[model samples]
Target: MTEPKAIVSDLESFVAIAKQVIADTRDKKAIPGKLKPYLEQLIRHREWLDERFRQPNPDAFAVYTLHQEPDDSLLIMSAVFLPGQGTPVHDHAVWGLYGVMENQTEDTRYERIDDRSRPDYAELRVVDRRLVRQGEVMISYPPDQDIHRVVNTSDKPTLEIHVYGADLSKLRRRVYDPQTGRVKVIQARVPVN
Candidate 1:
């Protein structure tokens, strides 16, 4: 069996690298493609990524804010999900990158089939369901690839890191009811600790 790798003790460098990448991407005024490389780079930080999963919080999902641009240009956070815990089908208004840091998760991607002008009416179809493992990354942008749900299927707690084009906590996002085909506007909660 291969030996276990040492855990990373310093997260500062990793955060700095992410910040630089986001800044560069913004400077170029590019989205969608620019963040892919950044996500790949983050997934390569195995030790650092694993460090976020060390302690499992039994409360609501554990979320740690790593960095956020003053202008809301970018936001990076580390999220920990306990077993059987997950999110509702939701959409982020801006671009996003999700990277698995520990264990495994089920990511269900959806495609909207109705018009957005009628807020009370909406429809969605499952386009894909993926098993995202450590070192894997997923990208999503509004209008095309933004609606999805993430669930921690492992018995133990799972950790993941996310980078958003805007400060998610301040954005007005949407959550869809798969059965009723209704959409509701909601604000993302700010990460704690």
Candidate 2:
């Protein structure tokens, strides 16, 4: 239905809970049975978070931290995409999950192929493409697993709830050359006064 009021307070709290769940699983070498329900609840919460993104306002791109420790981190990201707003092909190094709140989005996955040249780079070839709709959850892994791009394919707008395993704002995310697959880490720009 709708996102609960409590989940919107801050992103750090959501990250904390997610990190705790991840830690509990790693420390015990397996996910504890008790955490199963919590995981499902988080998934449901993610769905609700996405609902808040169904508008075309950039002001709606509210991101909150769920966790930010050295070992593990989590973030609850809400994004409202206007028509034609899309991301360049890139990779999220850590694991992540996203729930679509409204409308639909298109995701295209690529395969990295090595190319030796003056500048060593990887070539990307589209291997899979999918159209995801409302209430759908997409999960991804790191490295060679899930290099892809996301786009809102609707005339109106779309909303999505994203759960990241790391602090993406602080991390150096890579953007790949769609044709050459050359990898370059994107740095944040500091605005001058």
Candidate 3:
């Protein structure tokens, strides 16, 4: 059995390491060849984050702030989703990884298509849908690929660990309405502090 303190500590450690890697990658303007193997390894650790997210939470969503660097370049956060609680279709412009710390999360991906000329709003095509069970993870690279929505699909609340390569505070992310096909800018707030 893992203690809550230990799980939180581990997340903090990994966030620190990943932050350095992100900085190095930025400086090199490329992902270093030597880091490829470990990058994959880090992806594996993302699943480990699910354990901490499994801890109890009273609210529909709870965030545990593991790290908030001085420059706000990185943020390691955890969220708990009560049954049926979730965000609308949205996208993050920075790189991020999410792991199911407890239970399963159903997610759907969408592709954006602009129809600015018609004033009819943008079109979003469903790309994929899947249930991310415990120990499963997903990674998002911004700009090109980042639009999706996640929901808790089980009787019990779900937990998730989210690591962002950049601080997401007040960032304008796109939100889409599948039913209406409307696209709008929405601010992603750090609810956990």
Candidate 4:
């Protein structure tokens, strides 16, 4: 077996860089596209990220808030998903970049087929299902194309970092039922201190 890669020694510095990137592009129209490079930089330090945030829970997955702006312009978080753990099909309603830090995650992207204006009803169709591996990034934005579910496909814990255009924890987003076309408002779960 080969030796493990070295962990990132300065998570704070990385956070600072991420903050700067977000701050610089907060007013931009294409938030997700503009933040991709910066987010990719973080992915380059995945070994360090995984070392700092990979804590798998037995009952559920763990989400860690690495950084958040005072004005809610940006929120950076790390999430750990254990094998077989996943999220309900949900929408962020904000532009964001999700980068894999460790192992692999299977993301099933969807498209709403009916009028999303009706909160209680929604029709969705699967657009794509792909495995996002370590060092890879996924972009979400425009609300319409952001509905999806993420699942951990590996036996080991999977770690991922997300950079959002707003404080996702404070947003009341929508979770959809693909089978029944039902929709419900759900608050995004933020990490505890």
Candidate 5:
């Protein structure tokens, strides 16, 4: 599947293709894996991303909604990372696919090492660190294996695409502190969907 069967050169085309893929997958948990190849094709093409989403914010990083399914069953988004801006360790609590569109970024994945006895605290250990360059994608699976942080290692702005099984901005997800071993719930405010 290195070459696209149909050219997904625009947002609408990509969304249509994605919605079909989502519908074809019988197991809801497999949506991210099923969507990865199309997203990779989209990443390699780069024509589907908007020009406005390629710019970085001056004082902070920015996240923009590309599209969301009508039933709120899917969300596609773009994120612009300013130089040196990085996300804290967090979990999406749902399936997701992250594809790098322009430039590159770094991802740090952590593994929870503690027993699940407490709700407000977790002991974590660094499990993986890698550079996800342009045309690359990463997956976040819920319940486990979704804890990670992303950083813009480049000196200029970098753009990345995000596709989640649900509207992540409205969900109360978990945020972690490695230093204090603390956990907090946060609902992110995002650009209009």
Candidate 6:
């Protein structure tokens, strides 16, 4: 396991680095893709993540905010998913990166195949499905490549690092039900802490 001190240092260092990258870029939406390599570097070596952010919720997947800018410019969170737990198909309205920090996870990307002219309705097709092992990353930018569902198919628990351009809890996101062609816009899930 990685040393605790170093882990904290790395996290702080990453926040600073991410801020700089965002400031230097003209197109803020490109931040996630630009920071992908840096994020991979942070989680490459699987180690004991902070206990505070690893606590599980028996009823639902858990999310804990590790860092957030006062201006709501950046939000960093840790998510824990128990075996067979996952999220409803949804989209983040902002650009961000999600990295697998512990065990593997199944990420299924969906593409809206319908014209979207119908109100409160949407038809989606699976565009990609893969087992994202530890250290792998997922990226999203609004209105394009922004939809996915993540599940912990493995028997053990899974931990993921999520960094978003906005305070996700404040943004309203769209959730899709492919079977019913239903679409609902709702607030993002609030973090436990």
Q: Note the Cα lDDT for every prediction shown.
A: 0.73, 0.58, 0.65, 0.75, 0.82, 0.82
Q: For candidate 3, lDDT tens digit of each residue in 45-160?
A: 54455556455555556677667777777677778888877778887767777777568899888887764464336677888999988766677766546788888878998877
Locate the minimum summed-lDDT window of 10 residues in model 2: 27-36
TM-score-based ranking: 5, 6, 4, 1, 3, 2
TM value for model 2? 0.68
Off by more than 4 A, model 6: 1-9, 45-49, 190-193
Q: For candidate 4, write residues 21-96 as lDDT tens digits.
A: 5566644446666556556666676445545566778888888887787988777888889999888888887787
What is the C-alpha local distance difference test score of candidate 5?
Answer: 0.82
Can you give the TM-score per candidate against the true fold? 0.80, 0.68, 0.74, 0.83, 0.90, 0.89
Q: For candidate 5, lDDT tens digit of each residue in 1-193? A: 2344776666777788888877887776677777787888777777656678677788677888888888888898889988898888898888888998888999999999899699999999999999999988898787777899888988977888899888876887888898899998887734221
Per-residue alpha-carbon lDDT of candidate 6 for residues 79-126, written as tens digits (9 for 90 to 100): 999999898888888888989988999999998888979868998999
Task: Please tell me which model should have the higher TM-score, number 4 or number 5.
Answer: 5
| lDDT, candidate 4, at 81 | 93
**Which candidate comes out best when scored by TM-score?**
5
RMSD of 6: 4.9
- Any residue pairs clashing in model 4, and if so which? 8-48
Candidate 4 has a TM-score of 0.83
* Candidate 4 global lDDT: 0.75
In model 4, what is the error at residue 13, expressed in angstroms?
5.1
